[model samples]
Target: MEDTGIKIQPTMYGIFFEDINFAADGGLYAEMIKNRSFEFTLPKTGWLEPNSDRHSYNKESGILSIIKYSEEGANHNFARVEVNNDEGYVLINEGFRGMGVKEGAQYDFSVKAAKRSGDIQKIKLQVIDSLDNVLGATSITPDSDSWKTYESSFGVTKTEMKAKVKITFEGEGEIGLDMISLFPQDTWKGRKKGLRKDLVQLLDDMNPGFLRFPGGCIVEGRTLAGRYQWKKTVGDIENRESLINRWNTEFAHRPTPDYYQSFGIGFFEYFQLSEDMGAEPLPILGCGIACQFNTGELVPMDELDPYVQDALDLIEFANGDTSTAWGQVRAAMGHPESFNMKYIGIGNEQWGPAYIERYKVFEKAIKAKYPEIIIVSGSGPFPEGDYFEYGWEQLKQMNAEIVDEHYYKPPVWFREHADRYDSYDRNGPKVFAGEYAAQTMAIASPKNKNNWNAALSEAAFMTGLERNADVVYLSSYAPLMAHAEGWQWTPDMIWFNNLESFGTPNYQVQKMYATNSGTDLLKITEDGEKIIGKDGLYASAVKDVNTNELIIKVVNTLEIAQKLSISTEGSNSQQGNVGVLTMAMDNLEAENSFEQPMKISPKEGSATINEGRLEVEIPAQAFSIYKIKG
Candidate 1:
């Protein structure tokens, strides 16, 4: 492998973040309770009142009810408990399938309360097991007449993933409680109010180039009225309104009625996360069209101005000066400067003449206001066929900067289609493989998998994406995460429950390519031609300008090892000790588990170059990266 002299763009390997499969509220938001603000449609979805059993036996036990304030603001609802005695009338918070607690780890418990009447003397907070045994306990005595904040801390003696937060009042009295919150002190970067440390660390390890967020179909809800409105996702957490997630019902696997967006990890947090991870921020907004999979509703062209305006306002919010209105809001959120966003997308998996009409309006408005901002247009869900071809044709005519494409096919489809982008026109709108993963069963099937077969196939396809770096500018795996028990979709890149998280073999493949991505593309050929599934091997080459190293990736989706002869043409002074990282599994279905997350992960080794060329053996069912020093 040697330098072909083609330059790979900095935004080649990135991430796509969507709020599906409990990825936001129950997974990444760091809040233990499911509906902490009592904002769900049921208002009591995640809460369980044990008063039915105990109150019947003793009338002294209290009854809990909800109170709703004026609906003008976000924190419009709170829970009210009327207690007659300390007979243990309980309010239990069934966390996202129960909170994950660790032994010797401290947790912070806080609440907002006011004493309206009665001797409501104390409020005790305890983390209890399924048998009602207390794991850790902390109490707060609220003697104030107006709403004020209360805080306390406790440490568990044992680790448990099915732990619940219990609240019991002492003495007879009337109390108002809102925002009963609990957070693990050990968050990512140890920020007081932060993301799940383990989950963020996995993303940080990838060294992603950019982060495209607020996504999938959530940006375009089933109805235009229910779309993800970024205006409502910024500012104070308590003030950020909650909405029903479009994926709340009728999923391919599990249907979650209690699913709602608290916006705890909102747009502001997304930009901050991108900054923390040292990646560019790419935000997608609605374009007046609802999800085509559902309603396929469209806002009349005459009334599409607001949707276009949202895109303009977002660019201002991300890269505006403090003197501007939206920039003032960004500054008040503690980031006085800017997110420095470079790309803005109009729709997700959208196409057709209607999409083109709306996209044209958005393009003119966005470019008229901010010419330097790159506009990412959309291609329909399927990566090929009439709609995809039509989108590319129309977008290219419009001189669109980038076009987003997505596909989820069988593992064989990936390996066989390694040259999917080879025929793409070099002068057309560049590609953004925005949402893609090799499906083992079917699209979003509960039985689908994140097995080694899918990973290796993806690696095979990625070589083609890299080989066409001039046209394919950005790529990412779809639906980045899922919760084991509460997930609606399978085959996610990262899997987690309440306590622990692990990356699948697919995730390892993504991380390897992203972290090892070089600055320039090179030619790695056998028989003086590009390698594409010949001998069950796929290969691509690149050069890292910063490190002065030439990198080559090889995927062997075969049952036997393949030996390659040395021939680098060493005329360009490309030579050195070859460092190889190989990821292989005995079985195609072999998976990474919580106990052994890296079971099928990459393994590093050194290979001495013979003379001027590097000779190596690629193992069966493996994806390997060779870093050659220059």
Candidate 2:
């Protein structure tokens, strides 16, 4: 290992979270009731009244109508039900593709209700299976004429994956309901209405360096009016307002019209989560421009104050003292201490002159107000050509701190571009390899799979990223997760369903890199040159001062085993037994599934060093990490 004296940034290996697929409302947020507030474009998108035909509102047990409290305000709509007969007047919620409940687990149920007319005494909430068998049941009695929240909990007797919540009203009468919510009692940290336990545990296990949230193209919506606004995603969950998810129609292959952002897990939760996981909070915001791939809508240059102001307010919200306005808002939500956010991104994959113009305004405003806060700019979507060149040149001239770059290419591209950043300007704006993934098929194609080929290639490419840790401050895999049954994009790092989740081979690669991310960068070369896919081998080395150990990552992408002898340079300390963690697969198409999550998981082994040199045989298509203590 050649000592380079370069310090690796602590924020190097991070996770990029975009609410694509059924990630949030369905997958992560732990909210089992869909369209809880009745605010979707179609108010009853996830609700069904089997006995009553909506076309004629014909005679049935009950007829439900959506009522708007006001033309304005976040929580505008609620369900008003008129019950004719109490026998079968039932309302069922099809949770994000059905809820997953476990036996012996307590499920919490809550709703805001008020009796509008005759004797509606009790509300019964039941967790029922596909055959309509009740798995768990709870009831709440509403004793108030005014809107008040009623809550109850019950333990399920049977574990069911495709469970649906059934609501029945006792005694025929008129009633109003809003914010009908259900969550597993056993959530992450045991907080009520918190994130999914299993899903979050997977993320925490990685020890990610940072969490980039609430986004992808969602930050820049299809139109300016629909762009993600941080202010709307905080405070009371009841008032957090839902917006139609941009991924609802982003891909034609996977049309999810019911997808929307409930914001149950909003900005405050993001900061809290980052704090919980010891990851830096990296929030990327819109720059008054819509998604260029869509409408490319722009908010008039003169009216970009609100956009610029959002950036400044976000900094205050994250770092300001309790006495400040935005900080006070944050404190009201239960956190008084600052979140200590250090990075703010201006835009997401935006490009051209319009993005630069808006970014300039945000940069100027942010630096003037909070100079210590690092601003992360964008260089459009393309990794090369005129757009990249122009954006880089402009940001470099403006002295932009970090520029986020995204790439979703084939496995071959990943192997070929292992040294993509080797020649980056030493004096220019630093890079945030913000979003990247090895696509097994075409980019954004529905046919892609998270197989060993893609992951192996990514491991090979990441060597360059680690080697150039000085210029690349942060790196994270894009579209971090996907719902196996409801994904718009393909080849995600992690995939999940209603009942279970499994890390793909790509996820294993990321975990290996992130968990062993060292403190100091060291050069690992062959014949006086960096190993960028030499003999189907790629490697990088680093020293972890905190652990008092040297870590070397090597990837072998061949059909047969290869032997490597790595020698320590300029050190007389004799090496002892070297620990090894290896993840290998002979088949490129091999992948991990819910049935076998550890199909490609790391296996621990050992090697020995002779005369300050460590010799190891790396299996074909394997990613290995060798650790030697000084």
Candidate 3:
């Protein structure tokens, strides 16, 4: 029997916003220790103190104490040296006890000391490099006992240095020091500008259709109170919202190590960013009020109304007009016209029965007022029955517009099961691969070089998604950007910093798919003997309606090169030129760093057609798109 021709349909290639949140959190501490030094008063209590001067650290005490006072400049003082955890370390002018410094550098520091009698003393500061050489020194005199700050600058070589303050005893009297700070001549500060120009151009170049904002886990934390609060994030950069990050494993601190977050770049910023990028905004609202930090708990429905209302108000603000109250407020805020948001997601990865019930509530309320809008519900794994399946079942019963499917698995699994939705019921709700990433431990680790297997697997999966595009509407890669220093997850689509960014090999594959893939499914078949595997060479072909062009996407999964013979049996024009775009790299883990970004970029070549058949060799561990004019 003759084989059946393959079909292709419209598919979405996009990115999840979670990885951007990663950059906001552990990636870059985000406005925490700006310019290196900050000043604060030491509380009398709620601070911990160490017994020895060698070990000065904070545990959890209520007060700060300055101990170890020496008269006439004694090198050591035992009982007089007091310490407090909240107030941080104190400066005792005894022989200039100092803190560790960066290597190959010099620094100058000074402090103002206040005594119990309300008297003040100006103290000189000095720094020593790693070689114990005195690099810089400066003096400061306080006007009053009331808290004062002294300033000075010193130079250090391109090596490590330490900072210390010394009291030159002109007259014999002990001085008390509090609220002292030191500044390095140079510090590795974070990116001052919002987004890099090159990155902005790259984002613009992609011409993404839509943008998913905020985050995955960043939306909600272990508790209902900890969830992302959109209201707190809007307006005024200085007064923007903040929260503790929960994604990075490195944040495993003891005794509730407080990692405060500043929500400077919040919902308003996202809206503005989307507008600037010329992409539609798809915001995810929290469905489950209760959150799980180390453990899970449920929030009462009555108490959850506020959060629900917040979501409603947000939608209104985005889509409403000046005629309405919130809409007017939104206009005053910036955008007078409606943001025209047609899609809004309920919760993220809420895979429980309770979530289904909660989603139903959102669906009913949202649809009641805005029936034209598309409500996307989270659907779990395949074959149905999991929380996602249950959610979809509920959505189907309630008549949902779209259902989201998330998958993160081994590349090999994706390659083998690329046609996951091949037999899916199309009459049911539309499908969106809301979050999918092909990650393997071997390719993701920093220790390994670039691996093309992951990229190939993802490309093969894209081929399947493209072929099954009738049912699979939209898809995106999760954890898109991972900053090297603050990465909690691995194998991200792109890694960037203030100065530079680069797309992964897998990312390039998706980009090519998005840029070149066709919108219509074409009918094509291969000889049984020509098929390499059970599924043969992964392929999808589409004909563009406007340009009258036929695009064929093909992936050779075999280890050895495959020569493919192509022919358009149904078309009148049997012969056509073939434009090939291929992604091939020497090392699989071969990544493009900030220094060298185009190391693994795709290359283009062409092949000639003869009679009605064209033969081409496709390399293994590679992805290629063969385009033929219709």
Candidate 4:
């Protein structure tokens, strides 16, 4: 039998699990609201007509039109109108409802207009109350013969009784107006902050070394056309690109939102964010077609050059210097120094033989130019001889740098398999659990409700990942954020409204595990009593090389609190102080709400080490980290 008192040195090959996919989508879900959709347009004439799409309006030539009658107009019998091109000028008419306007309450005028011929002339906009008093006004000409657009800004004084929009055309040219919308200005702007700053700080505290973007199912589009395209998101804020977010429907659990996304937060923004957070950039680019399997039918190898070129161009854009053409363009956009991204993933979840062909093309080209860069390939599904196994075999032939894996299961499944890769081959390509989450069949369940027992299961699974850190290179929770009103999927880590944000119990658990663990794996054993008496107390240990500090992570998933007596050997009493960081809740289903963000948080306390033995008490339904000076 192994000696219980023998001490083992921690195996230190850098143990923090990374490669957690932690990026938010740049879709309309995050960026645009109802007021921002470009569907609304106003013509030069005809009565305001509602188009099939909710936000747009239609008008014929030569007459002024009002699509949205002012809400104030019902009370005071007046309405305002707004019009603009896509790029710059917004013409507001404040006197349309016979001039007199309400005081103290302001009416907003807005429109969607496009330039048809010469630039718009004296595109004047004004806001006047029912009393013919001009409250505010603004105007501008457009820059293109193309459909350049703009939105005007003006407000009626609160003291004014009522107000409406008025438009005057000085130029003799035809212009189109889809809709001229009017409402309270405040109503149109909505709220600016969606996520809570504290939650963001909590994630930052984990000190992740790298963040894998965008998604699991997010990367896998529902249709070929909806896949994530990096090129679509870049440049100045307004001029940045956009796309239809595929995950929106899943989160919304309904028909997808009608509006397309403006990918303002694209690859460049992700790189910038990583830099800001002191983490390395790991960019995953699309390969060939999105989420569809080819059924082993190959696209003729010669025709795949465009896919290969995209990979090359993306790398160049990320790492090239200002002296180059694309680099110069990137500099002109904003960043002068190359972002120097070192990890590039080719494709997402490609699981067929055709994927091998596709990957081969990208592999040869990328390695030839940037041999130092690590290449990651998606391996989908493995049951010994599944498609994922085939993908892994191909990677082996190609000497792939990393293998990306993803999973989404019920909480119970996670608990049973959290330590799944504990026996994984250590010499193989690094394993990256790109995306994972505990999803329940039931919708509308509260975030804290462990409806499917996911929280406990995931905690157990994470213990395995941490214990086998040498092989499990990275991991992250999937579907990180879901806007409460706009959710497309469920069982997310955080949910937010315009004013506040809250973390789920599972999220708090993950935070506790991530923050308290160290980057070194320690070996430990349990007596028969330790195993038989308590089944939920999963534990792992690590020693910090620099500080010579010993950190032990203990998760007690029982319904009642437990007292732990921890002992160590080959260490002196003169090392340092012992402390315990505990994350516990009174109930298993306890959660944090927007109004009470700290309802479920970590608490710290001191631990006593008497004669090289440390003893601490852990709360019920909780996880704790005990740190002892070496």
Candidate 5:
């Protein structure tokens, strides 16, 4: 191994989080109650009155009506529920494909309610299985005439994956309800309204370097009106208006019309999440252009000021002092300190002359104000095309600091293109392989699987990314997590059902690289040339200055085991045994399910260094990392 004198950036291996595949509402965000604010297009989409007779309205046991606010606002609708004959008048909230609850786990439930008419004494909430067995129960009395917030907590008797919240009214009267929500008390950091513990734990375990947020096509919605607005995603949760997710109707085969962005886990939460993971917050903003794949709508050049202003305000919110307008808003939200954000992406996968025009406006405004913030520009959606060529050429001329590139190609493409960035201009803008995945099938195909073949190939390709760490400043896989049943996209990094979640083979590969990503680059070569799938092996080497350790990553793509000796050049005799982490699968079709999450995970082994040379036998179809400590 020869020292390359190239420093690997701290923001090298990071995360790309988009709300597709119910990742936010149903997966990461721990809120169990869906349609919490009754703001969805179909306000009662997740609610059902099992016993009420629709034809008999108020004549039955009870009836529910969606009342819109006279003065239009974000919290536009409230449920006016009237109880006639209080005989099992139950309102059931079918959670995001049913709530996942563990036995003996406490869940906090809250709701805003007002006694509209007669004596609606109290509201009883219970967690019940599909068979109507109540596992947990809590109640709150509604004694106020004006809006009042009630909170209660209860513990479930048994672990249930498909438990639904059954709400019942006591006494015969009417009440207005809004923002009815439920969350597990054992959330990440025990925050009342917080993220899922297990899911966040998985992300934290990776020790990611940076977090790219609210993104992919989400920044540019299907139409200009639906694009993600950082302003709308901040402030009070009640006022953060919900929007139909751009992925809601993108795919016809796996339609997710119910998908929507509640913005509960908004921009502020994204920054907090980055802080929690010790990751640099990289928030991508809208550039006054809708997704080119859809409408390709553009905000007239003269009218692009609002979009540019959002980017400027966001920087202030993230790093400005409390005296500033946006900074004060961030402080009032419980975080007085700045998030210390350093990177901002102007657009997401947008291209053409129109994209360049809008990006120019944003660039000018942002550089004029927050000149220190490094701006990330896009190079279209695909890696190669007329639009991609034009976008790269124009961006190169503009002297952009960083340019984002995306590609979702077949597994073979990944293995063959290990030198994808070898020819990149050393003086040009740094590259961010923002969105990439090895597709076993076609891109976004429902048939795609997160199999060993794809993961192994990606591992082979990542060596190239690390090899060119000087130019490739940042890299992350797309569509991070997915709800097994509620997902529109396939082959996601992590898959979770209502009650359980498991990292895919792809996730295992990412974790391996991220956890061992060293500080400085080193050359691991054969005959003084870099190894790029020579004799079925691909490798990269790095040294962690902090740990005083050398990390060598090798991937064997062949169907047979390979033997090799790595000689540490110009080094004193090592004192400790080499730590070996092997993740191998002879079956390329192998995958990880909830039942076998660690099926494809790394297995710990050891090796000894003799005469400044480490001898090891690499398994077939595997990715291994050998850590040598001084």
Candidate 6:
């Protein structure tokens, strides 16, 4: 295989993050308590006051009462417990499908409390199982007249996936509590407040180009008021108000009413995660357009000022200095040095002239203030459609920096469209294949599987994505994660339950590409022709300047093995060991499971490549990469 001589951009492959399927509150954000703030519409949704019905305020030992703060704020609710009698009164929090606790691991427990009256001397926080068996226990003595924070740590003696945090008090009269929280002491990098170590580790392994924060339809909420507000997501964790996730209602196949964004993993955390992963930060802001799939609500043009301003303020928040207001907030957040964010996306999967109108305002405001900052525009939901074309045309006319395109289609569509970007204009807005997936079944179907068939097709298509690296600047797989039992969407790149997470076969493909992405893109052709599924083969070549090696990727989407005989046009080099990574499966439906995460993962092989041209065998339904020193 020979190098094609094109340069693979550093921002070639990335990842898209959204809170759908409990990705944030349940999956990434380590806050174990659900409805922690009592702010949900159904304030007691995750709370089990079985003691409620058993005991009334008139005759019971204790009862819980809801307290509301000023409606103008994000943290607007707290629970006030009137403990007439301290014994036998219990408040239980059923974590997201029960908190995942590990034996021997220490968990930090904290709560905000104000002694309204009575001598509520001690508050016991215990990680208890379904039958009330304690796995871990810690007690805090709240001493205060005004609201005060109480903290403690408990070492788990036992592990329980469905453990609840049981709260019991001693010598109590009445007390106020808000932001009751429990976090595993062992978070990613041991940060006091951080992301799930396992999940972040998977992303870290990918070496992603950029981390796109707080998004998908979450950016464009079902309604403007429900949209993700970056301002609310920043600041003190306790004050980072909660909101009904845009996905809290009904999805095409699932309804998870309990879903909400804790903002534990907010804009600041996202930037930090990007910094930690050595990836760029790309934040997408709402353009005042609600999800087109839902209400399709559009903020009136006159009322669009705030939305545009949010984009402007975000740029400052990310890159400005303490001299500026928003930038000062970033400094206070502990990252005084700018995140150096170079790109901001205006909308998510939006279309029509309304989008164009709103986009222009944001684009102008952003460019005028920070012309060096690049803005990512949208080409709507589908890869091919009237609105997609319209978006491209309009953005091209505007000389937009980059255009985001999303596609959720069948596996066949991906393989057939390997040449999708080859015909793109050389001088038009560069492409951002922002969100995409090769669905095993129909798009977004619960039955869809992240099988080898779908993954291999994406690999086949990715050949073209790499082949046209000059036109495609950024790309990523969509809806990055899903919590198994609570998911509303299927076919996520990674899936996790309360206990563990595993990358799907698709994730392996993404990881392989990102980790081995060469510095220079090159054409790998057979008989002077591009190999885009010709003879069931799709291939792309590149030269890794740092490693001084030739990297060739070949995908065989056929039923049987095919032999490849190749020769380099201008290369004459000695035989070198070819490091081969092949991800193959005879059964198209094969997938990776938590029990056997690497069952369908890539397998490494050593091949000796002779001086000039190379010959290799491509497996059926497999994606292979060959790296040979030049």
* True-structure RMSD, every candidate: 1.6, 1.0, 9.7, 9.6, 1.0, 1.4
TM-score of each: 0.97, 0.99, 0.71, 0.72, 0.99, 0.98
Per-residue C-alpha lDDT of model 1 across residues 377-445, encoded as one tens digit per residue: 998899789999898889889988999999999999999999999998888789999999998999878
In model 3, where do residues sit more than 4 Å from their true spots? 1-11, 19-21, 25-193, 249-260, 291-294, 381-385, 442-450, 527-536, 571-576, 586-596, 610-612
- Residue 44, model 2: lDDT of 92
Q: Which candidate achieves the best lDDT against the true structure?
A: 5
Q: What tens-digit string does per-residue lDDT give for candidate 3 at 93-206?
A: 211112334455434353444533322233455454435355555667656544454566565443331233332322223345543434344322212324334444555556
lDDT of each: 0.88, 0.91, 0.58, 0.55, 0.92, 0.88
Point out where model 5 deviates above 4 Å. 573-576
Candidate 5: minimum summed lDDT over ten consecutive residues — where? 567-576
Worst 10 residues of 6 by lDDT: 50-59
Candidate 3 local Cα displacement, residue 545, angstroms: 3.2
When summed lDDT is taken over every stretch of 10 residues in candidate 4, the lowest stretch is 12-21
**Which parts of model 4 are misplaced by more than 4 Å?**
1-203, 237-239, 248-252, 293-300, 381-385, 442-453, 528-534, 546-548, 572-576
Error of 6 at 86 (Å): 2.8
Residue 98 of candidate 6: its Cα lDDT? 83
Candidate 5 residues 1-630, lDDT tens each?
A: 777899999999999999999999998899999999888899999999998887774557888899998556788899999888774688999999988889999999999999988888889999999999999999999989899899998899999999999999889888999999999999899887899988999899989999999879989999999999889888999899999999988999988878898999999999999999999999999888888889989899988888888889999999988999999999999999989999999999998999898899899989999889999999998988898899999999999999999999999999999999999999999999999999888998999999999999999999999999999999999879999889998879999998888889899899999999999998888997889989999999999999989999999999999998989976553555999999999899999998899999999999999878998999999999999985
